[model samples]
Target: MPGSASPHVLLAGVDDATEAVLRTELGGRAAVRRLPSGEAVPPDAADEPTLLVVGADVPAPAGLVSALQTRTRHLAVIVVTGRAGADDTSALSLLAPAERLAYVRADDPDGLARAARSMLDRLALQHAYRTAQAAAQRRLLAGGEVARQPGEQLFGPLYHQVLIGAVAVDAAGRVIAWNRKAADILSLRNDAAGRSFPLLFPPHVRGDLREHLARAALVPSPPTLFERLGDDGAAQTLRMSAQAVTNPDGTTHTLVILEDITSSTETRRQLAERTSHALLSGDVAAAMTAGDPLRQRLQRSAQAVVDRLGVAVARIWTLDAQENTLVLQAAAGPHGHLDGGPSRIRVGDPGVGLIAAERKPHLTNAVTDDRYADDQDWIRREGMAAFAGYPLINDGELMGVMALFSRRPLPETAFESLAGIAGQIAVGISQDRLLDRLRATTEALQRPLLPPDLPTLPGLDIVARYRAQGDSLDIGGDFYDVFPLPDGQWALTLGDVCGKGPTAAAVTGLVRHTLWTAAQQDPDPAHVLPSVHRALLRENSPFCTLVYALLDPSDTPVRLRVTSAGHPAPLLRRRGGRTRLLEEHGPLLGAFRATGHPVQSTVLHPGDSLILYTDGFTEGSGAHLSREPEDLAALLASWTGPSDDRLADRLADLLFTDAVTRWAGRLRDDLALVAISAHP
Candidate 1:
């Protein structure tokens, strides 16, 4: 009724004056036109709507109504009568009975207009309803036949093809008659007359079924469910109802109907499980976006697995890079026996090792404990009947392991769910392990060689790693330090002294201490560095190459304002894998009485990487390292570990392990590396 278009209305047997009145009363919404007597509606307008307003005094009014209805059911007829014709029954008797019949008194001023508008409105509503019904049927059946209404012509021959089965049994529990649906569903002969009803029922429900039948004669009641063995020998749920009827001979008889609902019920159950699995997956995905600590995030995910999937002892194990063993990252369960157990499990089978070695998931029954006995004897003693283990592998590298155990076997749907959970665990474990290592390195870098271990600034994960190249007794002249400034920004420095030993070390210390003292007065590179340079000039400290950077991530693309003081240009890798060398260099620190270090500005998009290091990375001096910046950029491109995980490790390996080991001669200068990545 509120659609964009209104139905067409063709009015017949009306004078020009009356037609004008009808159109005005109808609000001019629909196309209202009057047709002359004995003239049929056009072919185009016939199927939409043609309202016939016939007067009882008109000639052959009944014939016109009959002809219009035969063309299409879209026609409706309203017969109006003057006061004289209202008393006559001849015209009414000639008309056929239909749902579209209406009557209005010709003497009434607006009766004909009201009837026409009302009839057209009804026609519009019927069209919309029929269209909606057709759309719903098309969606349900896809491409199947939906030309007519459901259960109309299509269901005429499908009485037996329906999923439900039916049969009739006498009061004595003897099957007297059965439909083909029953025979097909139960897998029996169509003419299974005089067969025993109780014999066909599954063994478990026969007793209750007999009791129901015994009570049927005494009580008039609703249908009761009975478990019956299907053709496949599995129990099927069937509803049975009984009624007692008197025969012509004055004897009483019972009629029973059987309907099966096992498949439909099972379908519902599986759908529920899948929906719950999707919800669990959504929660974990949400946690991935959250800023919670890795282990805490993993703990929440593990608990979700246990709660949604009904598994006991959900746990995550990460592969230790040094020992190559699976170490427990998080565990969730109420069982106390697992306390004080080996947090790091040795890499072997019957547990996590088998999942890794086989390169797939494994479902085992630990109760038997023969071929797959767990290394931990406690697991064997628990008698957990079901155990599911999935290897946490990413990009062909084994990151860790995730597993679950239960006292009872899980449903078939749960296995499908476990596969997806395992993949998520792999990503979680890899990312967390990588971040943990990076954080450890970062904290060591943050504290520097200051007053022992200082509490890192809270609420931000900014950390730095300084790796001095030497044994325990030997300390290198290369150094880096970070401290929080007054206005929520971070101040950091990475520098390399000219040479090693006492003079270089003293210069490094003096440079750092002078910078520290200057930082208190002013932490900006332009403000602080000039004072430190003047003091270093007075002290005549050894020359050191350095870069001072201010880190500010509160903008769309994280901003870094850096001033290069004769150090190597820091490399920035964009999120798309391209690299850039920020070449903004000035005189070495303490080289001039008053130095003007040109400030370089850059932004880091999410997932981008920035690395600052000593020249040792490029001029491998004695080693066969890549001396060209282009070669170094190519090497940086090769170390593509999971960006969110192990990116710092990859940077370390490229600048230290891989490049340093390939030196042409011998190592000379100390190396300092600082790497950071932007989060999405």
Candidate 2:
């Protein structure tokens, strides 16, 4: 039967009148059973009895106390004496264990019945506490989250297994309940149940605890750490965490937990010091090497850590940006194949599991432990009996992780060490990334400077363009200009410098400024070419190419005079759909020591056009025509009288779009175009 079904009583050593009085008082309240003497009580009777009433002063059998202690471990035993002195009470305390004993005056029937009823109530409570504690243990062992209620008793062997050092305090800071572990650590007994929690702690920690408790009560969540002293009088560090217990009526109580973390804290401190030294000395040495040497040095450092710390396996995993996955970098022990091999794990892959999901340290004591048996296959395959892993995070971002696995259970000290080392690794990775970013930024800033909008010219519609070579690291060394000379003539020039990137861009800038100065000094387009070419060759190499032209649209026939310096000849198109190349013969600029080069002149009617371009247009393996010079002539011959901007935009689209499609999105070089159109 259930312990709470009915109140049970075992009666002994009462006179007939007293027995009659007791039965009259408790007959309806209790289920009364009779025992003649302590010797005659049945062995199985202890299970059925809730209270045992014996004569307090009666001389019982020698083995009576021992027998009662054994059989009635769960039963409450009450002693009644006709008349007893203080010494008798003291003797009774020694005779019976406090957990099982209660004393009452036998002459007072009312007092005897009250004592028996109170003992039955306490026994029922203890039974319920054990039951609740058993249920909680099953839940915890099954890996389920279990919540507790305020003032609810927790008692059981299994409860102690999960909760090592547990204590409960109320809002007022009074100790409500403490388990065996807490009591042992605090050197407290049953009398400490209602004492203030502050009195149990050392003087220095008492005020801090009160403030923490008060803050915990005021906050919506909980506080994680609090301090206290140990029973051995040594300074102890305790972690006091609290959960708020709320009732349906909105009343609140705090369920505080005291965890002894003295050993764990000290272990963390020592591990941090060791990790700092290793990172400072070892990482620097490893970073000094190149390629395989660096990787080997890193692996050796990891191996040294495993040897010094007595760990079974250690591994490092790094993030791969190309694949967007984590790949094992280095490893030691039975799973050494993971080192420098591709073991890609996505952010939330099923096989990757909770280690990366939580972004914190994950620890498991045994592979077969009931709490994690559901993942047993993975655990065994990795040869991980005890596992601890921490993320390598820098600036609050996860870079990778360092993990240690053991075929045997790991001590708490090992967990602390691994966590500290993982943090140091994170710092090293952050530093490497920052340096790489700085280099990339410095390289990206060297592109050629180009004006957003070209200057407008009266009676002339001009379109100028510049493009960078796709294969080039920086910008191309191309330059173009369309400016009016001082003598009422429009002068234009296009040139290609020697190289690429910052050096080429610098040469282009120098040539551009020098030609503009030469044009201002001598208004003749023919004179400007030699002067600018001479200035460019002085500071630059002989590998340059240039072209200069002068257009006087005010003349009746619209005269055009042009000169070339190793540049592509200009192409001209007439209104009647005939095109020809204005191939003026001249030596390439900066090539030979030259004196005077002849100038070629031509006249254009209204509605005629000319196209000037860099080699990027004709250098493509596949152009509009198989022959590049013939292709340029054909493209100009087919031109409609479109606006300069419209024709330039369409030209760029046709050239780049066809090139991108044919090359599968690869552009081998830059292309520039300058179109000059005269309106009728």
Candidate 3:
């Protein structure tokens, strides 16, 4: 037992009124010391048991509480708090052990005094128990009998009231002494005094307990372990520590300490689970935006879930709207192969299909026992423990289903995470489908803006190649035309309008029609381009770049008139493989009324070609190097390939292939090339 010294109470941050109340309530019970304003914390060393009382008026009382706890192991606390800072006061509770802390409202000074007195009583009991336990351990180590005064009489009553469970088992592994707290914690029978200590645990853990006890009896230092008991739903985790104590009769006894840590373990598990969910959500979101194809991106998302959550299998299905069915698009983990599994499930079918039909989630911890889960025999064979299926719905439309099977039972948190992932997957699918529709619509609108086919003219091999920028989802503004005009002449115009989509497509139509109508009135390239430019300005349309050429194939050497309106000059490839740019320069059309559309006249001899193209051929997409006009001229100069009616297409293929190879198929601008050759 502790020396019969009086207990001390340290009062800090308390009003005179509260101090008087505490002193009156604890009068003659303990020595009361009022702390100075500077010394808010009690001294670490005290002659006897000590308690600290903190008032709510103290600035940052929670900090003081935490500091007091770390400064001394012997002090107990009674915090007088108000309703205002309930969260801060609650944090103080976790800082100290339950038995060593108490909280009372500041408004009730009487209640504060009562809490202080109760905490003091607990401190006294703890001090006495420690003193008696020390004496018992000393006697045992000396191989001497413990005297009755400080042994059973002093220790017995205090041991039962200790906060943690204490049980002493003899060398035979039978319980020799069991405290009231131990019985309450273990809920063993009244006859537990002589029962084998290891047998007190459930059958599965008894062997582990026996081995731990034996190891503890041979070691000087106590070793600890956290053991979980009960089934998955109601499991209780205990932090157990054991050490051997030798008795006076030369017999060995092991003292075991048991602390119920089920709540704390669950808290840690929940925290870890929440962190995993956040990372999983981030990973799935990243996968959704990854540059992979739609199916590959979905597959990556499925694989992420299995890798992050340790699930047995994860699969994603996409809706085939025409068939009204779910098609398995991605799979990971066991059953990862898409061929062998149920690749297609009709709406209202079992499992994933049912989720899609209902447009809701289906979650069950026991997949084998759930009647709604499909393929129960396979689940059982694979030892599947949990199943979660969520319908991938966006804006009230079913997109698909995402489902997973876990070998271990999953918690409610897993279902919540999966639901969020399902929504992301649904959005991914919807976005891809929407893009597909957009490309289709844009393509349909784009086709009519260009000539259906090049007109076949005698003595002239005319072919054109139009390639829209590959990287854009919107319709390109580049257009090309080859149509016969009056007086045995053919008009060839290739131009690129500003912007994209509907507005650009409309402008493209206007430019093509205006040029065709103007050429009918006059076959001169200069007059035709300026007329188109005037029409655009009259309509308040966006500006454009154009290359217009009037070809008269009936002439002996095929006379040509080409003009430029802020467009690249046409390339003229001579019959001997020499190349040169035509001298045609002008301002871009539709910007100003004073802009020029300068025309250049040239004669195309047999086996010679004239090529007009847009800027997309020179400027590649993304990080690709720009192909200058000189580069195109050099390319044309080096051409040893055959020049047939498909010469335009062959040249376009060569240039486009270089761009694709250099930039990995990401072409930035739209391209249009028109080639006119005289019997080449």
Error of 2 at 86 (Å): 99
RMSD of each candidate relative to the true structure: 20.8, 25.3, 14.9
Write model 2 residue lDDT over 446-529, tens digit each, in one string: 332444456565445577766565523456766787776788887777878777766776777777777778888896756676
lDDT of 2 at 259: 71
- Please write out the lDDT profile of model 1 over residues 1-680, one tens digit for every residue: 53343455666666566667777876556677666556677666654655667765666666676566555546777777763433443554444345567887777648777787788777777777856654554455554543232222222224334565555557778876555566666676644567778888767777877777776554433678777667777878777776554333355656555677778867887888889999989877766556677778778878888888777688877787688677777777765423224687667645565565676777765445433434346655665678777787877778777777887788766877777777776777677666667656534543444334222432222334455443212446777777667777777778887766556666777888887778777778888778767877888777778888887756757778888888888887876668878887788877776488888888777777777788777765644644866666777776665666445446656666755575534555556677766764
Model 1 residue 659 lDDT?
50
lDDT against the true structure, each candidate: 0.67, 0.63, 0.78
Pairs in clash, predicted candidate 1: 622-665, 623-663, 623-664, 624-662, 624-663, 624-664
Best by lDDT: 3
Clashing pairs in 3: 621-668
Mark the 10 consecutive residues where model 1 has the least summed lDDT: 147-156
Task: Please give the TM-score that candidate 1 achieves against the real structure.
Answer: 0.41
Of the two candidates 1 and 2, the one with more favorable lDDT, higher being better, is 1
Candidate 3 or 1, higher lDDT: 3
**Cα TM-score per model:** 0.41, 0.38, 0.68
Candidate 3 RMSD to the real structure: 14.9
Model 3 scores worst on lDDT over the 10 consecutive residues at 146-155
